[model samples]
Target chain A: MIELFNVSVQENKRLILNQVSLRINKGEFVYLIGKTGAGKTTLLRLIYLDLYPSQGNIIVENYSSATIKRRQIPYLRRKVGVVFQDFKLLPDRNVYENVAFALRVIGASRREIKSRVLSVLTQVGLNHKRYHLPHTLSGGEKQRVAIARALVNEPFILLADEPTGNLDPEASRDILELLEDINRSGTAVCMATHNYELIKLIPHRTILLDNGEIRREFSPAEVQQLKVIE
Target chain B: MSVFFLLKEGIVGLKRARLAAVITIVSICLSLSLFGSFTLVGYNLQDVFNRFYKKIRLEVFLDSSLGLDQLEKLKKKIHQNPEVEAVEYISSQAALQEFQKTFGQDLSSVLKSNPLPASFRVVLRPKYTAPERIEDLANRIRRLPGVQEVLYQKEIVRFLHKYLGLGIAILLIFAFLILVVITILIFNTIRLTIHSRMNIIEIMQLVGATNLFIKSPYIIEGMLQGLLGSLLAVGILALFVSFIRDVFYHGIQVPPHLYPFLLILGTLLGLLGSYISVNKYLKY
Candidate 1:
């Protein structure tokens, strides 16, 4: 459902992503493994229509990312969900409002939004914390709240950038499991992370990036072999 | 999206930023009050000119040497002019009696004989009050045999006309400048307020919020500010008008009819200022 063809992204006169071609099919769970400044976030931004490629083309759900008008960007965004590394929750709002915000932007009816937000919050194990503000929640709880917000709209794909970057080991494992369950429910998930240890445990399709290029793709057996040493 | 939702969100935003909203509304009210006062001054000045112009009459002094036939012929000729609305002839005796009544015993002892001349008080049609028309009528009256001097308040009319034009021009300029300044002030306030909410805007943009969905609340808030500001301005102006009337009770002859005009102008100014400010800041 997402395709990139030789896409190059440049910011501040430096190439961030160099001739990167990648594809994730429908319902496929893919993990993008890369080091710092390896263009993982840039690639996700390109697919989400937040930033256009400096060169080459990107196709997300059959819509050309480069040619879409500014007004059409919101519609495209509704079809895809993005989870940021910082959680990006409004501090003044409670957990329920944070998730309901996603549906509100899409002009969902109040009844449907309430039901959907409650169900999604319950799914992410955040139903009891719905009335708590973002600052009052723990790091893991905030991440779960962000995940619930992303999934509340029932998007076709979920692009998460280090969803567990701030969480403890136990909390990180719970988030990863929740993401895996979401993927199994038929929404394609593409998560970018640098933690090879978590990758060893989860065992998904892995695309490894080094120095602005996808240098390796590991199958299940190869991934298992790579994890044997860890 | 339903208008009810838009309104609810707008009210919530206004409530969240109540102080800023009140500041904006008060600023608008102050500016519109000044505008309304200027408009009232302009309206009343026009009324004064209208009243003064309508009372103007032309006086034609008849020559003492003219015979009765010549006087009758002069009157007939003066009536033929389209500018003359009505012409009434006053004989020397009648003029003397009117002068005696005005000056009383002092005037009766000063003059043994009646020196007052028989005159024609000519009232012109309202359309003939222009400078050129009055001049034309005066010139025509001068040509009559029995007419000695044809006098009207031509200089006063010309002066009032010129000053009235200048007054209107100055008022319009002041109004335009006030509108510009109000727009800039309100725009600055809104820009600052929106800056405080920039993170909210960014978050909304990231979550697939359409521009309309995001901007509707701000626009509705603007409208509410405008409505409330104008209402306050009108109320304040009403109080000011009442105070002025009490202070100048019977001293200044301001017409009571101008209150409605002032209220309308104040409301319009408030609405316009809010609209200009909101439109400028809400654009992406």
Candidate 2:
């Protein structure tokens, strides 16, 4: 579970997120919808403690931002997986190494790394692309590899920052579907995106963010109605 | 497991950044060479002083008009001094013989009479070889009855002792400066080399890699560069010593332990350089 208590993040005297309070429970799939510079990525970064909260406290699993030491940030990150929009895979490493890298950093055993990497690769349908470099993989497969890397450690939450930003429409659909599958398997996923159309596929909860604040929350029927009305 | 990966990555990093790695190794080589050459010169100078310190002796020239009993008494008195280790009485005739043996011309033939003075060649105890101590012993011997003058190599010892100390002090300063320059060179080299991999670093951090995990590879990379550079320096120095044997006389007196000392020093410097660069560059 993740909790942000009136969190405010600043970027050089400019307020990015102002008094934003958000909570994500286990197994919940929440969509963070906002326009460019609407503080969507900043919110996700705050959750991962990449950008510290300027004026509030955030609790990710057991680590409280108010009291967590600088050294404990990495351990906090291990429990919350982050998937960047660019897929940020090590260009030199193959798909297998890229995925296993997540587990490797957490000091996972060699046998655990091998087995878990394979299992997660299978889940993301990237088992066949093992040993293939990042440049060789398709956009869809690259996103899948990133997802597998995020999931290999079996984190409690997956903070996806535009997981399908660079993908084509068809590829985006596959990634969204894979995320839904992951959420169903009891892993909390907070996916940030501007694509309203993708919100209709599995609309559990969609939190609309505008000017660093949540404007509204929509249920599955409301998302469907909004899609129909639009 | 982490160590294995770190070492592998360190070797891999060298191959990946060949130019930076080469620059680091070359910089370390030059720095250590400067250090090694200074050490060689310093030790050789000390060797010169040690050679003369062992051979130092006072020539106690006796008065030409002294009676046989007075000469014997002077020799006995000089030998009784605690500083005197051994003394051999050389009469004017024997002195002339030694002079002829050394110069290949008998002093008796050169002059109407054997003019070389009778003296006692007084070898002092090793502890009295110090300039001040030897001066004190010489003064004591000069006061003996029928003794004309007490002579020892004071000027050469003063010159050697003065410059040897100054040379060691200067070398220490040079070593300190060299260490600083080498550390900075290595820090920049490794920092520049690893900067391009910031993306990988951030990704690793996002994936929960600890600071130690991120830093291990860079540390190991520094050590590798140091090891290679020092070995190259020692090999070149040994080669130079082998080609020129007269400086060392018989064999190069560079201690066998110097190799390991350099290796360890290089490794420590590498670690320090990497630690500094990592602390500066890796913000996360």
Candidate 3:
């Protein structure tokens, strides 16, 4: 669903990602494990077309970084949902409005917005607190709301950048389970996190990045061995 | 996106920043009202000047020894000029009679003989009433045979002519300044609103909203501000007009379409200001 051809991103003469190549197949749930400043977020940003590659091209679904028009970025974004560590919900809006906003921007009909927002909220187990404002929600509830917002448009892929960074251990496990459920339901998910411990909890495939370069790929059993080493 | 959704978002934006919206609207209202008042003053002042110009006439005095046939020929010649609207002959006896009537004294009784010269009162066409044009015509008339002198209110005409142009120029400068100030105020207000909602804009972009989708609400907000501000300005101008009529002159003439023109101008200015600001912010 997502492929990068030796992509490189730079900022003010500093290389953020250098000659990085990877492919994420359909319905794959992959964990990007790296330390701070390891180019995990930069990789996800390239996939969403938020920042162009400095040296190479990326193909996400049908959009290409080399030939995509500036105007087409929004349409590309609609097909790929992203969640941030901060949740990025509009503080003044309630849970339902925050999720419905995603559909509204796509000019979804009023009836369709309500229906899809409710359905996604139900999936994320946030339907009961739909009217509660962001400030009133707990950290885990907030991330769930963000997930519902990302899923409201039924995107083909989900990119998460440290989505559970602010959550407690229990909450992080719940979010991980939710992501797994989403991946099993046939939407690819690429989650970038520095938490090696979480990878061992329920691992499918893990790519270890170090200093802007991919070091190794680990399967479920290898992730267990790494957990044993730690 | 639906027009209704865009409009709702606009109203929601205004509601979100009530104080800023009110300040912008008031700024537009006061500036437009001032401009409208100046426009009305210029309009009425032109009317007064036109009425005054219609009454001005050139007095072409003839030599006292000119014969009756020569006087008639001179009158015909002067009347044939394209600039001359009409020419009325006034003999010395008639001139004396008019002087006596105006001064309320018998001028012939005091002079022992009719000393006034016969003259033709020449009324020029409206377009030829400028001070310089009148001077040119007078110079032409002075070269005619049997012509003694051509008299006009030269000093008064020159004063009004020079000052009227300066007055209009000053008025135009002030109107332009007000327009600029209002535009900047609207622009900055919209800019501030966009700055406060920068996060929302980013989120909208991430959620696949087009540039037009993000900008439509701000544009609509600006237009609404303009419409309301202009309506207030028109109301204030109406009150000013009535006040002037009641306290100063009852014959003040206002253009029938002044209010509508001001309303449309205010609305368009708002639109322009908001459009530029949003486009700059979006870089679209």
lDDT (tens digit, per residue) of candidate 1 on B66-147: 8888888888889899988888989988888887788674454787877888999988787666788788889889887777
In the range A1-230, model 2's lDDT, one tens digit per residue, is: 88999999888898899999988998899988888888999999888888889999999888898998888988888888889789989888899999988887778889999999999999999898898999998999999999999998789899899998999989999999999899889899999998888878778788878888887888867877654221
Interface RMSD of 3: 1.2
Q: On a 0 to 100 scale, what is the lDDT of residue A206 in model 1?
A: 89
DockQ of 3: 0.72
Predicted structure 3: lDDT: 0.88
Residue-level lDDT tens digits of model 3 in A9-68: 999999999899999999899999888788999999899888899998899888899999
Expressed as tens digits, the lDDT of each residue in B228-279 for candidate 2 is 9888878877776676676546744674576677778877887888788777
Q: What is the C-alpha RMSD, rounded to one decimal, of candidate 3?
A: 2.7
Candidate 1's displacement at residue A113, Å, is 2.2
Write the number of the candidate with greater lDDT, choosing between 1 and 3.
Answer: 3
Q: Which stretches of candidate 2 lie over 4 Å from their true place?
A: A200-204, A215-230, B1-7, B52-57, B64-88, B109-113, B122-145, B152-169, B246-252, B281-284
Order of models, best DockQ first:
3, 2, 1
True contacts kept of 2: 0.76
Give model 1's TM-score versus the native structure. 0.83
Best to worst by lDDT, what's the order? 3, 2, 1
Least well predicted 10-residue stretch by lDDT in candidate 3 chain A: A221-230
Candidate 3 lDDT by residue in tens digits, B87-106: 99999889998998899998
What would the TM-scores of all predictions be? 0.83, 0.85, 0.91
lDDT of 1 at A47: 78
